[model samples]
Target: MTILGSHFVDFDTARILVADDDPILREFAAVHLATPTLEVEVAEDGVFALERLQQGGIDIALIDLDMPRMDGFELIERIRWDDQLKHLPIVVVTGREDMVAVDKAFAMGATSFVVKPLNWRLLSHQLAYVLRNAQAESSVRSRLHDLQRVSDLKDRVLRLSRQKLTGPLNDILDSAQTIEHLSTIPEISASLRRIAEASVALTRVHADMGEAERLTPAP
Candidate 1:
């Protein structure tokens, strides 16, 4: 693909939305990009496109810069602004190869762009690549979010352990140690030593929990 792309898209099932003011272009895209595993949906304008997108199930979108009701740039912005639609892969298909328009589309969160007079033979490959890229990005984002959540939970647990357990445990260990030293009776000293030992073990466990985050993760 001439523009940005990613992993091969799934051939088992994929849905593409083409939003353009030109019915001919829309029809052309639908005809060429479709496969047994991939289906294409068309919208004559950005407004209609956005509506279909809002209903969900689209895996990628090919958008035209010029459209009534809502332009491609605005549509891109709107899609990115909507949390549910933000990650949807968007490829801008423009009539001109103007760099400014291309940059603007990207700034508005388009996944990629294609200049006019597209090569029909390569269009499907381009769409597949774009979709794969989007999915990979989404996967990375989800993993990072999950890791953050685990980090936050670990912090909360450590804070609780320090506040509610560690201080009291230290006190118990100190008291046991003092009692063990003060007592002359062997049995009493032995029992006090065990209490101190148990307290020490628990405190060590808490410390280990605090350090667990730095430990190497399982593959």
Candidate 2:
């Protein structure tokens, strides 16, 4: 990870897509977004952008609102609907100040908005923020999934232990109880005490495992 301004950017594995009809704007975005660790790919239109996205490994998309063939809004909607691309962060770039357009872009699932005649430096920071936040969210989801798997495995183990060990443990407890009742000799009584204590310990362990199973959160 490399520090850009106040934010840490792990751009070594980050791939960005810049989609715009204008060659100059696309080049400007590509250049500004690119770093030694980051790779930026440009698309002439939404169609090309969608194609590149389909190919995968695009961490974020910088898209122009107005373009020929497929517009940004349509592209955004399509991307949002796609299972693979739904979680992808998209920042819409537009010259229009119209609230309706902005609202529509957001409604269609644009992660952020950037006005054209771009501030290259600020744009870089904004993109970094979006990427970082997305990455963080993704990390959280992955960790949650791993935790859930562990919880599930614990539950399964608890169930199996109870199923397999319960009968034998009960037998041990029953035998200890019988020995306690029948034993009269001092040595036999002492053995009974040890057996009772061991039985109690095993029962506590079984109960604790059951409690852990109950406490384990559902996926």
Candidate 3:
């Protein structure tokens, strides 16, 4: 299906979990939400939903506020607390007048909310929007982490390059000094002097690199 401002969404590869105690609502969601590219899995209650989620492969979750065994509120809390499931996008599906439940769902980290008497025609589009936005957010976070890693590596390389050059530069300077001391000829002494000056300049460059490395913040 097409999402606004983007290419066609490949729902087929998406695995959606519908958690509700009502059989009719579960069937309705499965029929309306399913597509050629998408697979919808139904859970009779929050406990079953948690079990399936723990088994993994759930890309998104549609949770009902009222259910037997665990209920959606508690399930959302458990999911948020679990490291593996904490990042999963959750959409709370509830009654239109359930404002209290809605607020609690958001506070518990529900990605979004949907009101029922299910909008059969709009369900797919709405879900697509939520999934797209969640995916975009995840992509941005991943890119930021990659950029940080690259920046850190660059800083480390700069530090290592300076360290590797320091000893060799000191040895070059020492050799230049020895040559200048042993050679009494004016031309030879002048050449050694130039060599020593060049070595000192290179050493200063290395020192500048060290200072820059220190100033650069760690990622």
Worst 10 residues of 3 by lDDT: 3-12
Off by over 4 Å in 3: 1-12, 185-188
On residues 115-200, what C-alpha lDDT tens digit does candidate 3 reach at each position? 98887556676777778787788899899999998988888799789979989999999999999999989899999999999999
| The best candidate in terms of lDDT | 3
RMSD in Å for all candidates: 5.5, 4.3, 3.5
Q: Return the lDDT, model 3, position 17.
A: 97
**Candidate 2, position 103, lDDT:** 90
> Which number leads on TM-score?
3
List ranges where model 2 is wrong by over 4 Å.
Answer: 1-13, 68-70, 81-84, 176-186, 189-193
Better of 1 and 2 by lDDT: 2
Candidate 1 lDDT by residue in tens digits, 1-219: 233463333454789999988878888877777776789899999899999999999999999898999999999999999989999999998866488999999988998888888886567778878787787898999999999898787777766776698789999999999999999999999999999999999998878876774463532
- Which is superior by TM-score, 1 or 2? 1
What would the per-residue lDDT of candidate 2 be over residues 5-80, giving only the tens digit for each residue?
A: 6343445468889999999987887777777667899999999999999999889999988899999999999999
Clash counts for all predictions: 0, 0, 3
What order do candidates take by TM-score, descending? 3, 1, 2
Candidate 2 vs 3: which has more TM-score: 3
Model 3 RMSD, rounded to 1 decimal? 3.5
The ten-residue window of minimal lDDT in model 2 covers 1-10
